[model samples]
Target: MQTVASESGSTLRNYASILLLLGGICLGSLVGFIFGNKVEGVKFIGDIFLNLLFTAIIPLVFFTIASSIANLQKTERLGKLFGIVAGVFLLTVLISAAVMAGVMLLFPIDQGNTLRTIAAQALIDNPASAHQALTPSAGASLTQVLTVNDFFELMARKNMLALILISLLVGFATLRAGEKGKAFAQFLDSANEVMKQLLAMIMKIAPLGLGAYFAYQVGVFGPQLLGVYVHPLALYYATCAAYFVIFFSLYAYFAAGRLGLSIFWKNNLTPALTAIGTCSSIATIPANLLAAEKMQIPDYVRNIVIPLGAPIHKDGSSMSSIIKLALLFAMFGKDFSAPEMLLAIMGITVIVSVVEGGIPNGGYIGEVFAITAFGFPMEQALPVAMVIGTLVDPIATLLNANGDLVSAMMVTRIVEGKDWLSSRLNK
Candidate 1:
């Protein structure tokens, strides 16, 4: 198991594999563009890959979370670990919100611009359709989201929120079960191991699957998506990159003291690139777990904090929310200069970022959340929200996943000490 784990952690070798996958994607896209009709059949290869990854997500999350928490019951620092992770999550969101607000203020989105008009017209013409399109399918029915019958429904990814809750409850119960619970915990640990082995197998084919998917996606969407919205997309990417480097770097430095940066980059790069391709933090958990393992993060910290962090620690969504809110207000010609409005935006954005699901166009649902919660003018903001949400969701996913690994390291460092990496090295 350790050998398999280390093989998964070979960051330098992962880079080479990543580059080859990237090449395949580029070549596939070029071919798909020139002969989309001929290459259309290859999309199923990508679907197969995603389906395989999806198969492991629920079980991996459940066993990993429950087992990690149960293990923490033996330690005195479970509360401290939770506190540090929560604190890091909150601090990162605040930093993201502040930086995003400042950036929007500096290079304010042009309200009357063509993209805004296109967004406004789409919403104005068919508001309901736009709403249906942007609203996440998973979030559409709160009843379904909250209530689940049978184990299968509970294990479904759409019900991940409930799964996490159930896992936490089970973990606490197991902690209190004493000797009998020890066997159950061992079962869960074995289950987690099975899932990790499954993950290693899945990753072996990820490059092929991801490449095909990217090719199909780019071929289908084409350059028109970017060509039309280059300005805003460019700004979004630039700021996102800045946030990852600056905010994430600071968090790493604080967490690990001197070796923070080195520890982060070496272990983090492949996962960041993986996030870019997967565009779903939930899907990236396998890779994130592997990277955390490679970083020598304590097992308890890696398992518990990383999964929890996926939903809660969202630097990317925070960054994108500010951009979406700022642009929406700009589109509606509202006065964001008011302190109350700014405060409202900040508060709502933080909430949305944390609760937002890790699904395609999930951030658009967040825009809808902002409009409903804060009573923003939906008719005007909806179109702009949809546009920004679609464009920035991938970048947001990148930040979201990358932040998970970083948060794992930081929490590990705080709970374990700064010399954790060096200790592993000296061994």
Candidate 2:
């Protein structure tokens, strides 16, 4: 009885922060519904919070990735970790794409007249948006995406993929430096710790920051959630929720039976909330890192996987890609069921999921790629895809951010064995 009481108290303590965040977000949402655009004033508070996270992200990612690799006892471990991470990322993305595609088949997303209305309104709001060309050439070149000509360009968040590549190279260099690199590796570790502390400090205001952000989102975009978008958005939100509950549970169980599932769901709330509130996988990295730590995921795995996943691994985007394709096909009166079309959709989904978050304006680039690939007129189709993308951004980000944590768990299990969680807890 005493142990039960103690455990209950501990559980309450563990959930206290989540409760506060939830309450703040709910209250802010209420205010938004009441005051509408008047709540835009509060968005600046959220921006300040987001900016702090953004400012810290490049350095944080560099330190975490570099330190994790630099301290690896064997270079072979790096290879194994990378291989597992890539495999898991690809598998999960394919699963999500298939899931969304299946959902679309069961209940096709037809925009009907709503497409024209929404498109017209979008064009009215931004007269130049329809004229804007998001051609493949507009996207970062392969060389530009992976390697910045000026080292200073790597410091920008828009060049995150380049930043990650540079970090890997630096880590490999440090590892190869042997005894001479010990001090530098220690410095990387120390810097990583400092970044973690900075993130924690920024998160202290998350309730307020996230609340304000939610208010802004609801106030500005709440009305747009109606009409033609209602069906597709409903499908997306419901699908994401199902995927979050169902597939993530299966993943956790796969990682370590019931224990993994319990731990993952228990620690997932904060990251989920942060992701939804910020609508950014990059911004939610700090919360995901904290959750990973609480789940007892190995430091090296979480450190490397979560940061890398932010830029590249996007189950949410993969799912969204299929839905976007379905919606576009519906609008253009194309047969989405053709085998060649399905294959192209799947391939594009993988590319968009892998590439979207890594480059500047990548989401738009992916949408444009889909539009042009399907032979849709860019002027008409681009606006529709962008609208859908914006409406689903919050839930999509929730999946993308939290997916990284679970991916870390799976990576740990494969690298550290089936008993990884139990062994860590026992220690």
Candidate 3:
């Protein structure tokens, strides 16, 4: 009875905390809607919060990943963990692409003349600037994307993929080192704990920080949501929300039955809000980690999966890539439903979700690839696609970031067995 009462009290407090965070965001959104651009004043506060999270994430990712890997009882477990992670990522991306493609078939996203007019007007206004902006670079070499010439470059958040790779290598090296590496392994664990504490301290202000950020987001970009991009945005946003509610719940239940579903929804709101509010998967890592911990995911699974998933396992981007391609096909009068085109779009979605996802403005490469592949004029179609990417980014990030948590749960289920959640709860 005492335990039940304590559990009830804890659940209530958790809900209350979630309400406070939601209240802050709601209030900020209200301020933005009320004040419009005047809400810019508070953006600096949000920036400060973001800066602190960004600052801590580099070391946080490094230490947590390295520690998780180095401390694994068996090297075979590491390989198995990654194998399962890769499988889950691929399966989810395929599902996302297929779902979005089906939606496009049912209700085609036709920007009609509106997007073309907007693109042409922009080009006319500044032909040189528009061309320069829309033109894709040769695209970064795989070498450049995966590694840095200088070690210090890995410290930047943009190079998170590189950091994760290096962390894995270091962990493997430490694991191979055996007893000689014990001290360093201990150091990594200690540092990881410290970084977790630092992240907690930073997140204590998330309500304020996220509130201000959302204010700027709504105040500045809210108006833009209604223009030429409205139809596609509406479709994309609705699809993402539906995917989040239905598919993610299904994933949670698959991971561990009814208890898993309940725990996931209860713990997911804060991370979901963080993802939408911050609009960066990397930025939401800390919050996702916290939520995963609450879900009682093993440290090794959550730590490795969350950080690694930030770069590669993007279900949201998979959906967005398909939407962008469909939008372009609609604008250009291409038959989007052609068998070859759908197959090609699914292939590209996988590439965009995995390859371009980590690189800065990497979506440009995917968009340019889609445009060139489909024979659309880059100057016109690229601008329209870019606008769609920007508008859907927040919600996309919501799916991208939160998807990692559920993936982690699923990974835990596979690695630790279907009884994993039950065992944790029993403990």
Candidate 4:
């Protein structure tokens, strides 16, 4: 009974902390909106918070990936693990795009004329910039990603995939190194622990950091930001909420029926809320890790899947891409009924979703894909699309972060059998 009471109290505290952070976001946004430019000085707090998060990213990725890979190698299910993760990831992306497309059709953004006028004025004001933005540059990003010409460049946040590849290679090598493999794995595990501790220390300041950032965003963008794009923004948020509830519930059911559904909601609530506050899936890693620990997921599965899923399992971002493209089509007066256009929209959205984690303001960068692939007039269409991304990023991130944890749960069930959760509870 004492143990039960203690567990309840801890759970309550965790839930409270998440709510408090959310409250901070509301309060900060309100204050910033009210004060606007007058709150410029307060922007530093948000900047510092973001900087701290960025600072932690590399160490977190390296240690977590290396340690996870090493542990999984010992299990010899590494190949099967990757195959399952990839299959689930692809299925989610397709589902996200399909759901988003259907929702947009139902609650379509009907502000086409207003959006067109706004873009026309932007084009008139900055024709040169618009021209440059509109030019096709399809292979530039891919080339840069593949070149690896500069070693120092590979370590940047945007090059996390590169780091991950390197880490996997090193991890596998370490695994094959015999007794030395054990010591190396232990070292990496210790590093992961150190990084986790560091992240916890950083997260102690999350509410303030997240609040400051939201305030700064509101101040910069102004109180009327959401009002200006209310139609699309509201629709996007609503659709994402539906996606989270409907799709994730279905996923939970498929993964473990009633018990999985129960565990999914219970484990994901705090991390989902945290992701909403931070608007960065990477920022929610520590919280997700904590949730996985509480859920009794084995460390190897948790570390391998959650970190990799952060980048690859981007169902929410994929949905956002479709939403953005739909809005752009409406804005530009394009006929969406064309089969080719629909295929282009879905294809580019999936591609953008694949690298969403690497791009800064991924929601915004996804607009670039619109410009290049879907033939949106860059100057006029990009700004409107950016507004949508900014407005919808938090909810999208919440879904993405929650999806990562659920993927962990699903993967654990696959690897450990359907009774995984029940067995953990019994133990």
Candidate 5:
């Protein structure tokens, strides 16, 4: 009975911690909104937190990945693992793009009018600059606009696809190499272990981080920010919901009817709330772990897939990205042919999702990438992404939190002698 009581107490504490953090954010945002620039002080603290998160991300990726790949066996299982990951990844991207395409059909951003409105505005308060170069040479033919060169250049700049390619190649090569490679891999393993511990230490600072982040956001934009981006944000959020409902609904229905839905909801609700409130997966991991335990999922599944999936299989991010690129095309009066959209979808799915891990989850990485790639004013994209992405965060958390379960279920079924793919598909 003490064991049961202890478990209950721990669960309560976990849930309470999440609530406390969220309450702090809301109160801070309210205070900042009312006071405006007065909260600039808090924003300064948030800036430091952002720097710390960004600092941790790059090393975390290189070390963890190097260590993971280094330990891969010479067995054929490595090939199978990559194949499955690649297949699922492509499927996730396709699903998200399809959802976005449908959303576009329903609520197409009127490009000409949006551009006209932007042009008429007295201020280009935060115009992106790199997109300026990519803007089709004023009347460049569709053929040129959708050229192999532009796509290739985008990749060369580590624009999403390029980074994924680099990371995958490096990881796989390290795995396939002999003794020296294994030695390097071991170094990376120790590095990843150290980073995780460092992250735990970092969490001690999160109350201040959350306070500062919200203060800056509220101070700079106030409530008007939400109103300004409401429409696009709404569309983004809806697409995210569509993906969650379509994909997970089917998975649950096929998995165990009401029981499956209950299972997913029970484990997912808190994480989903944290994702919505915090708007950062990195900030929500502790809650996700708490929710996972209640589901009684195997430790192997949680240990492997949760940490990995938080950064990978980011269907929500993919959808927002496609929309962001489409919006950028609109912002600059550039056109998007079918091929460009398709390429953008594929590139974001396969490349952006992978490298996005190394980029700070809620930091300036997206803005930096945009500034570097599109030569756009760095101010706009990250803020824009965050604004647009708010629509998707809750659903993204749902997808992400449950993607771990999906990986677990699929793997468990595979080991249990069931044909996971065929069986689930038929159901």
Candidate 6:
């Protein structure tokens, strides 16, 4: 019998996934062409996928954040690591935001009225609904709904942010609560375990959700949209690509041992592939852990960095979100100043990276919160969410996963008191 550990299954599945994706795109387009002007099945598919993405968000966030935070409390050397991580986090935001803004300025997706028409079609198909808890009074403008206060108010109404905040509070409080919090912690612990098991089942359904988007994309836009949107999409994709390439290149070039491109690719392929399949850095933790070991990240750094990076170090996703948001604003002829876009990215980083810890489904849940945050109507939100959820995920998760490998190198270098930077200067 073939060993269960054989990589043959993985290699075959990777190719199979690519084939299915391409075929689905073709099939969805043919359906769209046949169905004509009245076709709205894409919207139905969008909704189903959106629901699938968000179904376990609240519970998953509550459990994982609580557990992860509780564990972090045991660390004493975190002060310096925290600072380093924050610096990396901020640099990531700045780089991503700048690249996105630069691309927006250069390409300027304002194809006169055609772009707006696309935006309108996307909106009609994915209309927003009240979260059942916090619908504003009649006739609130999208602008009014988009203000910072409204964002926070949504949190108060138990939206994703609210859930993240609650998880942090409960988790931190539990840590401080000590023996007094034991019973409560036990309850949460049990709840968290059960939810994760339930979550495994939810993940099995992701491809279904993902498939819907692929089906609709093929059915609606076919390969044609790729040509039309290629200009804008290329800019966005390049921005994401730039992040992993430039950052890792700089890190490796300066490292004393010289981190070769081949080694980097070899060590990271599994995590990247896993991220593509799972659409989540958080979900790909096991693969990421394995990749770290393969890359020779010390156990300590591997242990801490991967978990931390998964939640707050969304270098890929944050940048991609910024690009998408800029595109959305561009579609409406809204001219947000460069600095304002940068600021918005900063705010988004805080919201996405800090507040969204232990989210149940990293890709789906994060994308939902983001679609809503970026002020797309629920109609526009669904397809946009689906496309981005699929498109950005593999790369984003790969970047986030790779953060551990790099951080391990950096941290181990730090532990050894080696000045890799100084040596580069000497050379």
Q: Write the per-residue lDDT of candidate 3 for residues 369-402, one digit (tens) a residue.
A: 5554444554456545655675577778888999
Better of 3 and 5 by lDDT: 3
Better of 1 and 6 by TM-score: 6
Model 1, runs deviating above 4 Å: 1-78, 113-230, 358-361
Report the Cα lDDT for candidate 2. Answer: 0.75
**Clashing residue pairs, candidate 6?**
28-218, 28-219, 29-218, 29-219, 126-378, 126-379, 127-379, 128-378
Candidate 4: minimum summed lDDT over ten consecutive residues — where?
131-140
Model 3 lDDT-worst window of ten: 131-140
Best candidate per TM-score, number? 6
**For model 5, where is the 10-residue window of minimal lDDT?**
114-123
Clashes of each: 0, 0, 0, 0, 8, 8
Clashing pairs in 1: none
Q: What is the Å distance of residue 381 in model 4 from its true position?
A: 2.0
lDDT of 4 at 101: 83
Per-residue accuracy of model 1 over 296-351 as CA lDDT, tens digit each: 78798888877877766788888888877776566445655567677777877876
TM-score attained by model 5:
0.60
Candidate 5 lDDT score at position 368: 40
Lowest-sum lDDT 10-residue window in model 2: 131-140
Evaluated at residue 289, the lDDT of candidate 2 is 96
For model 2, residues 136-183, the per-residue Cα lDDT tens digits are 223435686568889889876556667767888899899999999999
RMSD of each: 9.9, 9.4, 10.1, 8.5, 7.6, 6.0
Query: What lDDT is obtained when candidate 6 is compared to the true structure?
Result: 0.58
For model 4, state the Cα shift of residue 21 in Å: 20
Score candidate 6 by TM-score against the native.
0.72
